[model samples]
Target: MIQVAFYDIAEESLFDFAVIIAIKEGKWILCRHKDRRTWEFPGGHRDPGEWIEDTARRELYEETGAEHYTLQPVCAYSYLRQGEKASFGMLYYAQVDELGPLPAFEIEEVKLYDKFPEKKDFWTYPDIQPFLLRKVSGLGIK
Candidate 1:
């Protein structure tokens, strides 16, 4: 089973990885990975020497074709499993300003949702997505 805990952190934190919980005009942004038929936020492992927020930004643009937007750190989370080393990732909230055409690279397609989509992968729909949505709403987003 996957387990995670979240803690608020500075945007400039040195966390090595992250995922963006991006929204534009009141809709959440989700991506379909080329390798999996699953939808997830635009985020991943960070490049060496990259700041936590930059990782969120890079991943957002790379996955969603989001050029202009307001990105903020919601918190950092730790993923823990019974027999594995704990890993850290930052959760970011972005109000996308401009979204260019999605690049046909790692991500196959991008979708915007008013409410969380029910038909999604377990790790995303029930796990990652709801957690991110609560984090965003808890911060005052409707």
Candidate 2:
């Protein structure tokens, strides 16, 4: 089983990835990778010496074309696989004010949803994503 933990302090060097849960006009923004059918939030690994928050912004723009937006850090989180060391990441909430054409990046498509779909088949990382979604929802995002 994978285990997830939340920490109050976001130690910059410890975080390896950044993910943004974006909202545009009350709807959720999601992305589909060019190589995968499942949907996921815009996120990626941190570039060397890049601030974690910048990682979220860069990935969000690269994957979703969100040119204008306000981003807020939600929390710092870590997940541990059964045999691997814990991997740390920072989660963010983005209120997108504008979007341009999708960039020709790794993502194939960007979409909006009134609410997260109930079907588990829609997610790229089923087990992990649901937990992340629930954490965001707990913030009263809706």
Q: Write the residue-wise lDDT of candidate 2 on 41-104 in tens digits.
A: 9999999999998999999999999999999999999999999999999999999999999999
Candidates' C-alpha lDDT? 0.79, 0.92
The per-prediction CA RMSD against the true structure, in angstroms, equals 2.3, 0.9
Model 1: CA > 4 A from native = 10-14, 120-126
Worst lDDT 10-window in candidate 1: 120-129
Per-candidate TM-score against the hidden true structure: 0.87, 0.96
Q: For candidate 1, give the lDDT of residue 58.
A: 84
Q: In candidate 2, how many Å is residue 127 off?
A: 1.3
Model 1 lDDT tens row, 1-142: 6687887663444466888888888788889888877778889889888877778888999999999999877788877777998778888888998999997679998998887645655344465557766777888874
| Strongest candidate by lDDT | 2
Which candidate comes out best when scored by TM-score?
A: 2
Each candidate: how many clashes?
Answer: 0, 0
